[model samples]
Target: MTRPLTVALVAGGALLARRALRRRIGASPLWPMPALEEPVSGRRRENRRPSSHRVLVAERTEPAEGVVRLRLEGADLPPWEPGAHIDVVLPSGAVRQYSLCGDPDDRGAYTIATRVLEGGRGGSRELRERLHEGTEMEIRGPRNRFPLVAAPSYLFVAGGIGITPLLPMVRAAERAGADWRLMYCGRSRASMPFLDELEQAGADGGRVTVVAEDESGPPGLAFLGGLPAETAVYCCGPEGLMDAVSGALGEARAPHLERFTASAAVPGGAFALELRRSGRVLTVPADRSVLSVVRDELPNVSYSCTQGFCGTCRQRVLEGEIDHRDELLTDAEREDSMLICVSRCRGGRLVLDL
Candidate 1:
């Protein structure tokens, strides 16, 4: 009886040790995961995915009239750069990307401000009305695609809410003693965010220029001509302003652009997508995004930033000529993968390595 009890205890210990080893390997950053894991019972494992953090909305305040600033607190949160953004997931599962405008050194909390767009989607509206202090929310990413490049001089053009991402860059430039100038434009003083901060930064030196359309006419591109040829111009604003900046610069110099909106739709009618691993096919309409359709079939498919700016929904194109609409991916990344959120198939039928 004693011998049998000892054998049972040994078996239990071995089982626990095996589980601990598996957990350690799974958590290891060095652990290599296949592009597409082996299917279980002919279905891919979706729930066995990387988990996002649950942060406490520690504080909420109105910085501008219609803009709400949120201070999210978390433990051992990931570090982010100036232009990085975090995906704020709503209670209803809606995810919205907001730039991290707070100090990067502060790992305990993340600060993000969003302007309430009445005509736009419900993201900003939800933040304004629903989210509150002490609210627990899941967040993914602090990803950066609009990284500040080293240049002789910097020219930043920010319009209204577009200022969120560029604000950090301006602060970083000042700290590095880099030559940088910011041209901030808005509808009115009451509507613009971070005005006081910008004013404080400008007080010492006249590096910041605030232009309200009510007082002055729309910002003219005359300033563009005065800038040095090697100046790296970064612009984030409405489509019209971006177009004007691009047109003004011409081929002389290329300005780095960050769009708050998605790119123009892919010029195509309806197309069919085949989920190779799942063995399912779905039709995507011209007006509807591929993400919406893909979610209907595979409910657990990973996605964020429906605008195609984030590469979360990037799926391997097994056999399809992609329209490749997103600006986020590089020329090499476009060869095999596509952001299904905004991009579409140029061909009639496409296969995805789900």
Candidate 2:
């Protein structure tokens, strides 16, 4: 039998065995299943969460100009979905986020592409210039907020470095035999990574459009206009490209966007944040972030991404009002809680569960 058929047969047998065992146990008072809960609960209470994995740079290759592909050394790593990002703990103690660009089915190693920004905070530059093979670094998370949802067809639009996360999704869509098309836009052909792979994958009459900005006029909004209503559009790029796409989609189509920028700053005055645990009322400055204010007041508080993408700086809003600016929190999460990283108080005073 086929592998899937074998799996189905085993599952059916297991279900039958479980039903028979349950029937037999229903008549016996000494089955000991429920009695073992006490020990299980005790063990659960004692067990702590696993520590962050320390991954070594097994290999580093330059797939494109100003971009370095890093393969980390970890076989039994935690499972991660497409569009997931990992926080790399740099030597300078700076935590930087990078999208996982490798195949998610390959569990043996985690791969990420890093593009050195011209005015970046030295993380990418260091990775490109200084980091070498066998160098070890502390890695945390394969956290995902921009997950690929089920759609009849997909329209993926990526710009420059934004193609990193979409790479895996495209591979997954191909495996599932889903209808999808990718519009990868970059400055030039030489700057675009995985160009050869993308072209070869689509060589057998697949739909993949590579639009180089330097060689042609801007890809018009008409590109999105042709998409079917049943198709879900996914976009990731600079603010300009995102804005254009968003404008084209409007409220009628509502394309999903993964922002590479900080949340828009709200025009609001400063307010007081009351910590419920400490019974301390702290005044929040107009220019400072809630995470920064909290860190200044309470030095021991831990945080990873101050951009609110990571849930590390999350806090419950017990009372008062809030002006949420973080992209991490869902609409429901914003109603009950807040990400102190980017969110701020709306009214005069805000109460935090802390």
Whole-model lDDT values for every prediction: 0.77, 0.73
Each candidate's number of clashing pairs is: 0, 0
**lDDT by residue for model 2 over 139-183, one digit each (tens)?**
777766677776546778889888998888878666655556778
Task: State the displacement of the C-alpha of residue 226, model 1, in Å, after optimal TM-score superposition.
Answer: 3.5
Off by over 4 Å in 2: 1-51, 303-305, 310-312, 320-322, 329-337
User: 272-315 in candidate 1: lDDT tens per residue?
Assistant: 88999999998998888888999998889887667876567888
Indicate the TM-score of model 1.
0.78
**Candidate 2 global lDDT:** 0.73
Q: Which stretches of candidate 1 lie over 4 Å from their true place?
A: 1-51, 269-272, 280-306, 309-313, 327-335, 346-349
Q: What shift in Å separates residue 133 of candidate 2 from its native position after superposition?
A: 1.0
TM-score of each: 0.78, 0.79
